[model samples]
Target: MAKTFASVGDLAEKTISFTELGPGLHAFTAEGDPNTGVIVGDDAVMIVDAQATPVMAQKVIERVRSVTDKPIKYVVLSHYHAVRVLGASAYGASEIIASEKCRAMIHERGQEDWESEYGRFPRLFEAADSIPGLTWPTMTFERRMTVYLGSRRVDLMHLGRAHTAGDIVAWVPDAGVMFSGDIVEYRSACYCGDAHFGDWPATLDAIAALRPKALSPGRGDALIGEAKVAEAIALTRDFLTSTYAPVAAVAARGGSLKEAWEACRAACDPKFADYAIYEHCLPFNVARAYDEALGIDTPRIWTAARDREMWAALQG
Candidate 1:
């Protein structure tokens, strides 16, 4: 039988958890779904990676309200993915911030991504119509930008490309907590549909240099303490290398995409088979790795039509 496209069959809702990593740093994780980070500063709050839709964001808002009544002053986009940014309206944040590359991607492929993602994971797009168009960043920075809410210093830095060309992480220096958005996923498959396979390992090295005490990853449970943080980073690195290495080798040899996919599945399934979204992400991940290995630097834009075509060719 042919495989389902993306996460179409993933209908069950995940349990939500608001875990405190530091004094004022929190991680809003929903099982294996996309995670959001909350940093409560003295005067205000900053939200990392908004949910998929306004309705879904409301849950985060409710959780935010539970602990700190401080206004949500900023909503940060870790990258330009529809599931991560379309919920900006619900926060009513004074500023929506993103990396300059992310803003450019929003302008380039935001609409197509919205259509493609919504079609793939219907459960994540609850009340999809509630999203007020594509989320745009009010402020964009190049390498690094720092925002201070009183004495708390939150650094938004683009630590090389991994998940996307625009991927950034929210680093709280004083608290030693890093909100690694899609750049480092723990117990979850790295979605490499629009990823930079060649640059990803070096990026992970940069993250390791930080030596964060606690790390809130893009998905899965929050990593608290130095050991867990290191473990998660290593696991993420292994997933990326394991998935891309075999696929890239096959592609470099002028193998067919189907052959590359089979090679990737064999290489990655032994360890990552039980990880979240492993099955859903494998096809797209292998396809992108194959392209990258064949010398495509920039990721091709994925539309609904392209998604179907790729899935059919790979799984049919």
Candidate 2:
């Protein structure tokens, strides 16, 4: 039997855990689901990566309210994925911030991504009808921008491209904590549909140089110590290399995408088979790696039709 497209068959809701990594730094993780980071500054709060819709984001807001009554001042988009950014309205944040390239991506493929992702992950898009429309960043920066929540410094930096061309990390220097968006996933399969495989390892190296005491990854549990932080980063690196290398090799030999997919599955499944979204991400990841190896620097847009077409070809 053919597999469902993306995460269509994944309907079970995950248990949510809000963990405190530092004094006011928190990670809201949901059992390998997309995680959200909260930074409570002296006066206000900032949310990194909004949920899929307003209804879903309300749950996050409720959690934020439990800790501090300060208004949510900023909503940051780690990248322009529909599941990450469409919930901006729920926060009612004064400023919605993202990298300049991220904003451009929203303009370029936001609608198509919204359609594609919703079809793949229906559970994540609860109350899909509640979504007003595409989320737009009110403010955009080039490389790095620092926002002071009272006296605390929160640095938002684009640490090169990994997950997407516009991926950004939220660094809290004083606490030695980092909120790495989708750039790093701990025990969770890296979603490489829109990824830049060639540049990803270097991006992971940039994250390692920070030596964060606690790091909140895009998925899975929060890494709370130096050892755990290092482990998560290394695991993420190994995953990227293992997944891309075999597929790239196949493509280099002018192999078909199906052959590349099979090669990637063979290479990655031994270790990553039990990881969350491993099956869902494999086909797309291999497809992207295949394209990148064949000299396509920019990723092609994935519409809902393209998603099913690719999945059918690979899984059939």
Candidate 3:
């Protein structure tokens, strides 16, 4: 068994953490891999961000079953990333929910993303053959959607564009717990292949304003206390700022994409040296940052071939 996947620079192991965020909410975080949130309600359960494969999702399902026997009635996708939604079928949720923009993104480039991510990190896509097909949302909303699990209210809000144009945050008001998809990561590389680098900070500000007592970020350990929650958000903000600022500055000075990539690497390498997937993510992150810094708000599509070309260009 391949216990870990470290690409010369990434320092994180494939570790999973099951945290009790509140009375009936939990977070399953796996280093820098996609995290899954569990909400146990009076009638059933709701899961946020299924893993990349049915086999991998079963690990999350096992943990959920350890806590509650309630059937999973809802599976909320934070975005259209293949690693985040490919395992939706495993949850068997009655409704698969996402933002309208997210659904549209899925319709637009979901297949290409699947191939792109599988190529970039094969270890994360274990049991790839088990994926039935491209996962689609059964229900989608333009702005906000309030889902009730019996009497408990779970509000899914599209705060703003950060990681992607359709990123959504799941807020359990009663629990004071927020499940921030890839919008926030704790000591994890912020993958920016399809990111809005310029607008990402504003999105983080919206999340910080929530003052969550506990937060389940996309990676690393779940934040249990208010202090830790703030730290996670702060760390994520710092990482994004450090990664984009220098690259943008270089781009403004008529520097080439390759130069901007090196600048980004030089500036961020020391700051985020200990962060997870720092190496594997920086090449893609820098490429997007360079583009967004030049006023390209919407990120370019990243197919498997494009990913390799970008990586090779930025790397050399």
User: Which candidate leads in lDDT?
Assistant: 1
Worst 10 residues of 2 by lDDT: 1-10
Please list the residue runs of candidate 2 whose C-alpha ends up more than 4 Å from where it truly belongs after superposition.
none
Model 1 TM-score (2 dp): 0.99
* Tens-digit lDDT track of model 1 for 23-134: 9999999989999999999999999999999999999999999999999999999999999999989999999999999999999999999999988889999999899899
lDDT score for residue 243 of model 2: 88
lDDT of 3 by residue, 38-137 (tens): 9998999999999999989999999999999999999999999998999999988899999999999999999999988887777778789999999999
Summarize candidate 2's per-residue lDDT along 1-316 as a digit string, tens digits: 2256778889998999999999989999999999999999999999999999999999899989889999999999999999898888999899999999999999999999999999888999999999999999999999999999999899999989999999999999999999999999999999999999889999999999999999999999999998999999899999999988999899988899999988988888899999998888888899999999999999999999999899889976
- Tell me the whole-model lDDT of each prediction, alpha carbons only: 0.94, 0.93, 0.87
Q: RMSD of each candidate?
A: 0.9, 0.9, 2.9
Model 2 clash pairs? Answer: none
> lDDT: which is higher, 1 or 2?
1
Clash totals in order: 0, 0, 0
After TM-score superposition, the amount by which residue 29's alpha carbon in candidate 3 deviates from its true location, in angstroms, is 1.8
